[model samples]
Target: MKKIAIFENQYHQVKIQFEVANKIFFNDMLEYHQFNSSQDYTPISNISEFNLVIIDISLSSNSDKDGFDLIEEILIQNNPPKILILTGNSNIKENLKKRNLPDLPILMKPIDPIDIKDNLSKLLV
Candidate 1:
């Protein structure tokens, strides 16, 4: 089974949507690990355990780091998991360019459940 990690401050909302999408499109085959803040994903040792990571560019105000920082960290791993960015920020492209990060798949906020499943299908390929 493929594994996924979701990092989003709006945990419940994102979880519920993904759960529905998984059930309908993936037949509950995917395993999910969720984090509400950067700290929740700390130690970073387990980053390679997942097949994909879906991260929100903006996290809780209390976190010392944002998703971009997390992505940079992940990229340094020997074989990083695929990443799919989630953001409400309209300047996502600019922010990514500013950080000199590689092009990554992104899904804007208020994403439709079907879109979520579609992206997942593509990424998990």
Candidate 2:
């Protein structure tokens, strides 16, 4: 079983992500956690416990950095978990491209349930 950490500020988005994953994964098969702030993300800095960490670009209170700061924090870990960046906006697509974060996968939001299931299944396998 793999552990998953969902880092997002919005309740609806977090719920949506959880529902998508739950539909595909049984409860006993996975471990999950969530954080709504950079402050909240402190306890779970070590990525070894999670196989994947999903981050939402738009945070409710922390809207200044466009989530790049969270990305940077995750990168500081000794063995960072695989990252999946979720965003509804395409404006930052080029910006992220410039950064060249090869290990991260950017998933556009209004996320498709099928895409999440399929990609996660692939990761677990």
Candidate 3:
């Protein structure tokens, strides 16, 4: 069994969608956690418990950092559980290119629920 954590504050739509999708597809094999802000994100004491983390580039106002900064902070904190960035901003790729950061895959907002399930399934597998 694996665990998943989703960080998104935009009305919690993406979080809810992923929760439902994962529940339907992964069943008992995957557990889900949701966070609305990066500042509120506390590293799991047992990092081994979770295997994947989905981060939204647009967290709520309470978050101390945006998606890009959160990605760096997350990497600094732990080594396991691959990270996925979900953002509505299309310019993010261009911005990252300008900074020479790794090209990361992002899930655009208003995405179909089925696509979310499929993407996660591929990652988990």
Clashing residue pairs in candidate 2 are none
lDDT of 1 by residue, 1-125 (tens): 89999888887867778888889899999999988888887678679899999999988887777999989988998779999999988899899999999989998888878989889999999
TM-score, every prediction: 0.94, 0.78, 0.81
Which residue segments of model 2 deviate by more than 4 Å?
A: 14-17, 25-28, 43-45, 63-66
Model 2 TM-score is 0.78
Per-candidate Cα lDDT values, in order, are 0.88, 0.69, 0.72
Q: After superposition, which runs of candidate 1 have C-alpha atoms over 4 Å from their true positions?
A: none
The full ranking of all candidates by lDDT, starting with the best, is: 1, 3, 2
TM-score of 1: 0.94
Model 3 residue 70 lDDT score = 72
Question: Which 10 consecutive positions of candidate 1 have the poorest summed lDDT?
Answer: 37-46
Ranked by TM-score, the better of candidates 1 and 2 is 1
How many residue pairs collide in each prediction? 0, 0, 0
lDDT of 2 by residue, 8-120 (tens): 77756547666756656655476667777656655545666788887787765764444767777778888888888777877666766677655466767777667677667
Q: Global CA lDDT of candidate 3, please? A: 0.72
What 10-residue stretch in candidate 3 is worst by lDDT?
A: 40-49
